[model samples]
Target: MKTLLSTIFSLLILAVPFFAQGQQTLLLVGGGQRPQEALKEWVKANPAKEPKVLIITWASANKKQAYETSIQADLREIGVRQFLFSQDITNSFEKNEFVNNLSQATHIFFSGGSQTLIMNILNSDPQLMNQLQHAYWKNNIPVAGTSAGTAVQAELMITGDTKNLEYGLGFLPKTVIDQHFFKRGREDRLRSFMKQAPGNFTGIGVDEDGSILFKRDPKTKEFNSTVLGSKNIMVIGPEINQFRQEKILRPTLLCSQLF
Candidate 1:
């Protein structure tokens, strides 16, 4: 009996690391007013007592400084002191600096602007992309993004003009994410994109002043999303019957769906 109990304890100890690795966290905010509550929730996701945040404003062109200032104010309001910003990839030196910052960050954030521009820059550099992936995936750092930042988290990015589609950072697999969802009247646009999107990808449309926290379960290895803030998050999936005239199906899930 003593040997059997010892073997059970050893097996449980071996499972600890695998279980912790399966849990990944993402905080995606829709464009507009970022509620203090949402930012606080993001802070809580970090395991460190005082997380060092690295804000990447690659999506914004000339407004990078302005975006950083606003986000810095918010972070300070939440009692986050160790925060830094980086943007504008003009030379190899700047790109390398950004990659190095990724390694140091306990939590990484992306600010709002143009998703097209964000992907354009990320796609240009293989090293930068790999490092960002390593920081979030292998290192298990929590990632947060707002607006265009949120849109780039998915594999299929919905450009403001739904007619044109582009590849994103692919952080969220088999999903298409759109921001400023209902405020911009993008329901039809998202549906149209979902209908045309290959492989029956899921569509997540986030309204203004709202956010979704996606947490991957260790036991099931599936993501459970929790809605936060004042607005709604619309999730669209494929219809059960492929032969049906309407291939896209929008479920009745709303803010009530919890993690």
Candidate 2:
């Protein structure tokens, strides 16, 4: 326990130099499927250190040993070595153990499940969240999430219901992310958020087997987003409210493509 705390402290101390580098990269995948291309890109992007991928399954309710074994085997077939799976987390020891693993991680992947469950657990444990932020933003490690995992990355988290979005970890501000968009017919729900939003916020909706890769240009300091996988990625918002009489009009939404 003492050694674990010391390791975390050392990692935080070492991250000071890279703290201002901005977001490293983000791969957000819609629920219902996992795209192999996204995983390949994530592995290829890590030139900082040895490629070590950690999978967090806190959002998942059932703890199946076979699930972990299968995922590990699949990732291995695609050139990913050094794989780790963490689930059913409850105490500081478990959280600290996860933090220790982050020290060597080149990428972190969050599995699909309930967005609310993800937030409730992470929020209650700031220590774990802080370490995540340090590894992602400070240490410049890439991170990916699918389904509910994708939704929790936005500042305003869509609850997959008509109710207002809950506060998220805010990894990506000025954006609201929803998964299984077309598959679950969630376009109407995303529209509701825009209609009621006081300030303009971008809504990113990804369908099953689809994902978006977000990266910052090292030279220009600008962010670029690209679509990946076989399906479409929808981008809405930057809402333009032109009031004609009592009605408001917003620009038509569109989808984009990528190689």
Candidate 3:
């Protein structure tokens, strides 16, 4: 009986990777993103692929593990073209280097930390802001956000205004995303953002080891986003069922929704 139970457990563990095949994704860990397994997959997907992806970390609040030098080192080791948003400018250099790189990047990663810190950099530099504006609209590049990094993708951020918490970047123009969703028990907070923007924007609550894929079809101008690695995403909008059909989409439901 013990042997039978052990075999069953081994099979289940082996099946984990296959189950997540639906999502071709990577993790965006913060000060500490739980689930080392997820990080391993992220490293594998981003391994030294020629064009060498770029990472623009903006959410570093405290100067602890969020140091720019450290992040650049990690990215370079993985063969990524790392550029500190705060650096890259010289008397004769282009002020929008960060922005240009953003547009040209195959994959752009937003590291975790303080969302406000990222907002500060964008606000301080107009050139960078314009470049980000361009990247969000450009379909050629893929944007990956983690933790507070994920929070900025939405049009409205559920930050604390009373204490001067950072707002959002409004790149998504759809919903506010709160990371550590289930783990942090932040579903209610995520819903708050949806409530304020009711019937309009969505609130995405993602737990660690979870991911959502946003895919666009050029010929038909239609898009289908798939979720994997964990629980299905919650779609909050007006007439949510129909609204989900309109925007909030994922791969788990792709067969039925896209067809």
Candidate 4:
């Protein structure tokens, strides 16, 4: 019985890599002035000839229009022609329509605001969350987010106060994501959170104006992270309790090459 259990455990460990196959690209931007180069990378990730970008502004309330306008201008500059805003898709009557629209989107972006608001809405409806997972995992559509939007990408998300942790959208598994790293002086906060966190998860603290692009290698079936933008990105592994800062001098660099 002991030998059989060991064999089963080994098989499950080997199957992990296969389960992570076919995941699409994820672009996580640290809140602040979004680098134009990051936007270009996002636009380039879309494989569609006529890419339809969907902007989810559930995190923003008063700044929804402003955020949409700014993102639209940036996306337009990068040759994006079609755009869909989720401002009106709030009620039950529009849920099906929103899901349909998400299916057609070549790229999905979440605007910065409050991660709590985004999760609250998503958690209330399982169908919406499933559709988003389908779009990102099965459909291979690129998903991008900034600030609070970026926080939701992780399974463990640091709250606004930097004191408590909450369950996020789980787009990025077994990871704790924090934004505004240096500017907000959040290194200590992240370290504390990581210590209290349940599982052995890596903590990623993205500085303002910095971005991390997570793309899966088709052959290896493993996600390779690339640092983009002008500032530094802090990565704390489960084993390494100390902070490791990686400065991005160039436009793009693989995290594998760095650490």
Q: TM-score winner among the candidates?
A: 4
Residue-level error in angstroms, candidate 1, position 22:
3.7
TM-score of 3: 0.63
Candidate 4: count the clashes: 0
Alpha-carbon local distance difference test for all models:
0.72, 0.66, 0.49, 0.74
Which residue runs does candidate 1 get wrong by more than 4 Å? Answer: 1-20, 243-259
lDDT of 3: 0.49
Give TM per candidate.
0.84, 0.80, 0.63, 0.84
Error of 3 at 112 (Å): 1.1
Write the residue-wise lDDT of candidate 2 on 37-110 in tens digits: 66677677777445778887877677436446655665676688887767756877877778777786778887
Spell out the clash pairs found in candidate 2: none
lDDT of 3 at 191: 55
Candidate 3 residue-wise lDDT, 162-215, digit = tens = 332234775444556677766667666655555566464555666664555443
Flag regions of model 3 displaced more than 4 Å: 1-49, 63-100, 160-167, 219-221, 239-254
Candidate rank order under lDDT: 4, 1, 2, 3
Candidate 1, 94-113: lDDT as tens digits = 88788777768888889999
Instruction: At residue 196, give the lDDT of candidate 1.
Output: 67
Best by lDDT: 4
lDDT at 79 for candidate 2?
Answer: 84
